[model samples]
Target: MEYYEVLENFGQLALACVLGGMIGYERQSRRKSAGLRTNILVCLGSCLIMMMSYEIYKQVEGMTNADPARLGAQVVSGIGFLGAGAIMKEGVSVTGLTTAACLWVVACVGLAVGAGFYIEAIMTTILVVIVVGVLSHFELKKSTRAGVLQLTVYSDNNPEQLSIITSCLDDLHIDITKIKMREEYARNEREQTIILVMEMMLLNSRHYSTTHIVNILQDLPGIHGIELR
Candidate 1:
């Protein structure tokens, strides 16, 4: 490549870094796991990979035609594994999914820059900023205060009832992290009573209160008592 062309693509790489940071800034503000630095590096790294790939496929004076897109395709495929590592499941809720998605897209932007598709790179950066930064807040608001509640109720002479209650919790997306049940008798009068102790965590991290959880538990049948701790 000529001096000027090389300079121009280098500049593209720089821009990709800035754009990646712009997208990552929003995630950092929202306390996401992958913050500004992580995103910026992802974008810049992708750009470098793409640029290297392009250079590799270039048919020089001694070499014949080579497929450049081959390298770019591999770049994307490689990024997929990295993105998958960022995704995780917590009980009934999933986290890092959006962050992982952003990372993957940032890689694409880098590849675009390497391929000299400056316009597409810039546009994609802006769109990512809007979607990951702006739209995430709204999505959080919509899901806030909305979650599945787990409940455990105790009853005497009906141990099978506990299974039914747990089943209902599952249907509502309320997964139990721990469960302990005991049978006790008072005054030796065959006062066998079931004692249920359980723990619950909302899959969605939103603005919620214990009362909201309590109310949901109250609505469940056979849940005479509920405790969230």
Candidate 2:
């Protein structure tokens, strides 16, 4: 490659680093699993692959049928596996989907940089940052309004008590995401008590409030206390 060509490639790589790092920093600040280094590597690798593809096409130019996009197309499809690794399932809640998507988009941005689409790459980076950073606050606010309820319930060690609580939640149309139970011996009362911690989300159609949940549960027999978080 000519000296000028080498410098151009270097510039593209540097731009990829900056653009990818912008998104990565946001993810890192949010404590996401795919952050900083991961994003940078994905972007830089994709950029290099695209550049190689272009160079190969140039070298083989009239000698054979060469597609500069062939390698980039592979990168687009192959990146899915890396993105899939970022996703996680916990109980009924799935997390890291956004991180996975971020990885995929960052790879595309890198390809754009490598293809000399500097304007497009920079614009994409800005839009992605806004979506993941500024727009996330709105998403959070909406989620808070929708209400994911965490409740700690203390009750006598009776299976029926647990059943009743679950049934009540079902009746209220609460979508229970997770439940954890542990038995503890009450030193003073000389009886075994069950501590149930529940994480649930209230359906949008349901109008039940936290206070209503507490009141309903408190009236149930064998229930000692209910705490909401």
Candidate 3:
């Protein structure tokens, strides 16, 4: 290869590093298994393979039928194994799927850079960052806002009290997953008291703290005490 051609190829490789590193930085910031170094290596390797394929085709010219795409095509299929490694099943939820997808996309971006499709590679990197970085932020915010709560409410033996408590919970978008109630006689008081134990899930718990819930229930006519776990 001529000196200028080799310099151009090196330039392409450098671009691949930059594009891959952009994605890697996001993954690293989030503490993903495949972080900055892994993504950059994957992109750099794929780019080198594509460049080698092209060089091989040039050397053999018309000797036999040497296809530049043959080696590059293997990258697409071979990347699946690496992607699969990123996936994990934890209990009922599966994680790292997005990381696996990011690896695959990063490899493609590398191939584009190797093939001199600079615009395509840059654009793909931007879109992938938006999908994994920006979109993931919103997804995590929504998910973390939900939480489970266990509450024990002490109130007078009034049927209307239970109704009032549930009404308040409903207004706050709290779902009662499980509930138990029992009647008990107070040591100092002659009237019967109701002990309500409930397991609740909040759709947006961040909006309502445990103290806030307790304060709301304390204002009810029959409620005497509240405990939250």
Q: List, residue by residue over 105-152, the lDDT tens digit for candidate 1.
A: 988998888788889988998888888767867856655445433444
Q: Write the per-residue lDDT of candidate 3 for residues 45-108, one digit (tens) a residue.
A: 9999998998899889996778998888999899999999999864223678899999999999
Better of 1 and 2 by lDDT: 2
Which portions of model 1 miss their true places by more than 4 Å? 60-65, 143-225
State in Å the error of residue 182, model 1. Answer: 17
Error of 3 at 76 (Å): 0.9
Best-first order by lDDT: 2, 3, 1
Best by lDDT: 2
Candidate 2 lDDT score relative to the true structure? 0.83
- Candidate 1 vs candidate 2: the TM-score winner is 2
What is the TM-score ranking, best to worst?
2, 1, 3
TM-score of 2: 0.76
Residues forming the 10-long window of minimal summed lDDT in candidate 1: 148-157
* Model 1: pairs clashing at backbone N, Cα or C within 3 Å: none
Per-candidate clash tally = 0, 0, 0
Q: Which prediction has more favorable lDDT, 1 or 3?
A: 3
lDDT of each: 0.70, 0.83, 0.83
Query: What is candidate 2's lDDT per residue for 75-112, written digit by digit as tens?
Result: 99999999999888763367789999999999999999
